[model samples]
Target: METDRKYLFTTRIPVRWGDMDFYGHVNNTVYFRFFEQARVEWIEGEGFRVGPDVPTGAVIINADCTFLLPVNYPATVLVKMYAGQPGRSSVMTWYELYVEGDERLYATGSSKVVWMDTRTGKSVPLPDTLRARFD
Candidate 1:
């Protein structure tokens, strides 16, 4: 990842024993949960509430993760998330996971979320208020 790019949100998550696989390292699938936690926090921090009644928000359309190092239990992971360039109806969200108190990266991930009308399940343009938060 580029050192120059600034992250918009960051949070610490404790690794649970159940998060590990038979190999004793965090499972590959668990990384997406970490990304989801950070993304939800970032969206709420930007003043968007995700609920049944909420009319505007985003739905993840695509997601990916690249593991650089194995993560074990008894560790607190720091996750940093940033909003990339926004398109007409979607925005890219990038994530980086690291061992707490250490700078080295453990994994990197990204997701593309499409803005939509929650009630109708139809795509919508990114709201200016939400887009401005990325700036």
Candidate 2:
């Protein structure tokens, strides 16, 4: 658990049998899905929706994850998400995965999402409302 940084949003996700690989550990790709879910939940929780009609939303430009420990099924994981460095048109979203109720870190991930205008399909600065939520 990274104590120095405060996470604005947290979610509990149950590991499904299908998330495991032949080695009985969660597949590496599943971590990305976990990160995506956490990001979407955080966005919605902040009173923002990502859709065609929304004037401003984000499009993920890059994503990366580092696996620290193997996770098995029948376990719930805690995903903590927060904003990292914010740029004029993009922001880095950070994520930490932990074993539920434990301080041990299972993985860490990040994604760079660029704000865009849905109608014009062009990059745009982060809306003041969204930026305030991150702050």
Name the best candidate (by TM-score): 1
Residue 59 displacement in candidate 1 (angstroms)? 0.6
lDDT of each: 0.88, 0.86
Clashing residue pairs in candidate 1 (N, C-alpha, C atoms within 3 angstroms): none
Candidate 1 on 1-135: residue-level lDDT in tens?
A: 444445689999999999999999999999999999998887887788977788888899999999999999889999999777777898788899999978899999988889999878999999899877666
Clashes of 1: 0
Q: Name the runs in model 1 displaced over 4 angstroms.
A: 1-6
Give candidates' CA RMSD values in order: 1.8, 2.4
lDDT of 1: 0.88
RMSD of 2: 2.4
The TM-score values for the models, in the order shown, are 0.91, 0.88
Q: Write the per-residue lDDT of candidate 2 for residues 1-135, one digit (tens) a residue.
A: 323444679999999999999999999999999999998888888788967888879889899999999989989999989776567888878898998867899999988889899889899998787777656
The reply for model 2, stretches above 4 Å from the true place, is 1-6
